[model samples]
Target: MSARRILQLGNPLLRAVSTPSSDSGECERILTDLRDTLHEFQRTRGFGRGISAVQIGEPKRLLYLEFRGRPYTLVNPEWDWRSEETFRLWDDCFSFPDLLVYVERSCAVRVRYQDLCGASHVLEAENDLSELLQHEMDHLDGILTIDRAIDRNSFCTREEWLRQGHPATRPEAFASKT
Candidate 1:
């Protein structure tokens, strides 16, 4: 397994709906490549927590997550629950690392998925983890953060965001339109 090229923002394959993955032989290899590619991204770009198979040109329902020193391999992940309460944040993607999109997301979520070995498990995430999972899950369904932007003004370049001091987002910030 090696670090594969990440599909860029304009790649048509990024719009493909991923197919469910099996516990067959390719699971381990794909997961490995995902981890390698994630590490490579973090090393080069300095910020990346998770990646989906589709991001690496694999149209499979798989996700690799590493956050807070723990790693998770999610196969065929499905939403078990999503909180009604929402919050807003500026989200970025490895595929489009230079752009940030302001979007809203649920405050919490529970997901059902299988491990690399095919063991079924459920994960409940809150706050930051919730948003991160939602982002990656969107990738599985051929969605990107830009698609969730709050409005035409919700986009900012990484450079401009930094120039403006990388504004902090409260866990309760709604950025409501009403």
Candidate 2:
């Protein structure tokens, strides 16, 4: 597997819901590509924690994440629960790296998913992890960070956002988990 091109904003395929993954081999291939692509983006752009297969034009229900030195591959994930209390933050995406959007997200979440080997596992995430899960999950359903923007004014260019000292929405930094 190799680094693949990330689907940018305005791609029609980014608007299409991804299909559930069934083939383990294909899932692994996509997972590897996702890992490579995410790392490359991180190396060059300096930030990115997770990526969905759909972002690489696969349109499969798969997500790859590297956080705190741990790597996770989630296949056909499902939401177990989400916290009622939420927080707002400026979110960004590989699909539209130049734009930042203010959005609200659950403070915590529990998810169930299978690994590349078909083993089932559950992940209980809070704060940063919660937002990362929510962000990648949105891609499987054809949703983008911009789509979650709180309002018409909830937008800013990367340079402007940086120049403005990266406006904070809460105690956390104004960065999308990915």
TM-score of each: 0.94, 0.93
Supply the TM-score for candidate 2: 0.93
lDDT score for residue 105 of model 1: 98
Q: lDDT by residue for model 2 over 151-178, one digit each (tens)? A: 7767889898898888766223333333
* Candidate 1 global CA lDDT score: 0.91
Worst 10 residues of 2 by lDDT: 169-178
What would the per-residue lDDT of candidate 1 be over residues 1-178, giving only the tens digit for each residue? 8999999999999999999978557778898999999999999989999999999999999999998999988999999999999988999999999999989999999999998778899999999899999999999999999999987778889998888789855223334432
Q: What is the lDDT of residue 178 in candidate 1?
A: 25
For candidate 1, the 10 contiguous residues with the lowest summed lDDT are 169-178
Q: Which stretches of model 2 miss by more than 4 angstroms?
A: 170-178
TM-score of 1: 0.94
List the candidate 1 regions with Cα displacement exceeding 4 Å: 170-178
